[model samples]
Target: MKITFLGTGTGIPQDGRVQSGVLLDTGKNLLLFDCGCGVLGRIHESGYEHKDIDAIIITHLHLDHVGDILALIKANWLLGKTDMRIYGPQGTKEWFEKTLDVYDYLRDRFTVEITELSPEEEFIPQGTEGNCNCNIRSAKTAHTDNSLAYRIESSHKTVVYTGDTEPCQEVMELAEDADVLIHECSFPLGFPMTNHTTPDLLTLMMDEYPLTAKKLYLTHLYPQMQGRYREATDHIRKYYKGEVIIAKDLMVVEIQDD
Candidate 1:
């Protein structure tokens, strides 16, 4: 499986970072997670056709996470591709309807299948041929009432993505034994924040849950994280024995079967 960090920034703008987005190529299918602002252009820059995305899985309805969802659908329609499958936490269908209501011209131009998922629900995203060769499980997150974290298993590899949350047990349990945990580290080591993560807060949770993921990639960075990457990674390394990385926009990581 291949994972691409399309946009690593948060609602707050920063240089070189856009917003929350990740593209996962499971060899049999291409799945997009969190199509935030600027992700559409990032997809074009990543050398992948946006129309080829098999499904879009969202973690929440926050503007920073769902900003470019409509833009992507519109872009695909312009390119003569219309069918889209979108899966997300509760209210996904309603949110899409409300958003589309604003664009009178774009309404009825294409077809979108929206599925609202619940915590602990497992489902398969269908590819062009049929169901993709992977399974996805969702867990409720601490960021919002319906925010979720996803565990994707394919080709004997497991990857977990935490959309936006503070240190929480539900996500930690869902990420157990994952090959890579793409978590949100929104603030610096000691920054005081709520509803978002700091290095200190994450390590505190790790001390209790004992993260078993083989590798950890931090994303959803805020501007405060600038120049503190090494510090944050070092802090987490002291508590966990896995490889720690600060994800950057357009960076790619691949996991292969043993």
Candidate 2:
């Protein structure tokens, strides 16, 4: 499995980061998570064609998470790719319909299959026309009432992606024994916040979870992490024995089966 950080910024953009988006390739299928604004451009920049995406998994309905979904579908339509599948938490179907209502031209341009996933739902994602197979399971995270984090496994490798959440037990359980954990660290250490994660809060959870992943990459960075990126990693390093990296746009990590 291979994972690429397409966009790692927050609702607000920063210098090197764009918005929220990650591309995962489980050697056979290409899956996308969170197509926020700027992701289409970043997908091109990351050497991926927009038409190659097999499915899109949304963690929440926030603008920073689902902002560019319609744009992605439109771009794919322009490229002659019609089949697009979307898996998201409850209300996803409603959100898609409401979002496409404003764009009449887009309503008939592409065929989208939107599946509303319940908490703890698990399934194998067979690419369009059954081209590839990747098993995916999701657990509800602490971001919102319907937010979720995903665990993707294929070819004997596993990776967990926590969309946008405070350190939560469900996320910890989903990450257990995963090769890589792509979690969110929205702020620096000691910053008091809710519905988002800080290095301190993550570390507190780490003491209890003892992450099983070999590496932890933190994404969804806010502007508050501007000058304090290294500090955040350093603080969490004490609790987590694995590598902790602050993710940047276009960063790619290749997952190999040992």
Which residue pairs of candidate 2 clash? Answer: none
Q: In model 1, what is the error at residue 249, expressed in angstroms?
A: 0.4
| RMSD in angstroms between candidate 1 and the native structure over all alpha carbons | 0.7
Tens digit of lDDT per residue, candidate 1, span 17-92? 9999999999879999999999999999999999999999999999999999999999999999988999999999
Using TM-score as the measure, the top candidate is: 1
All models: lDDT? Answer: 0.94, 0.89
List where candidate 2 sits over 4 angstroms from the true fold: none
TM-score for model 2? 0.98
Q: Where does model 1 exceed 4 Å of error?
A: none
Steric overlap count per candidate:
0, 0
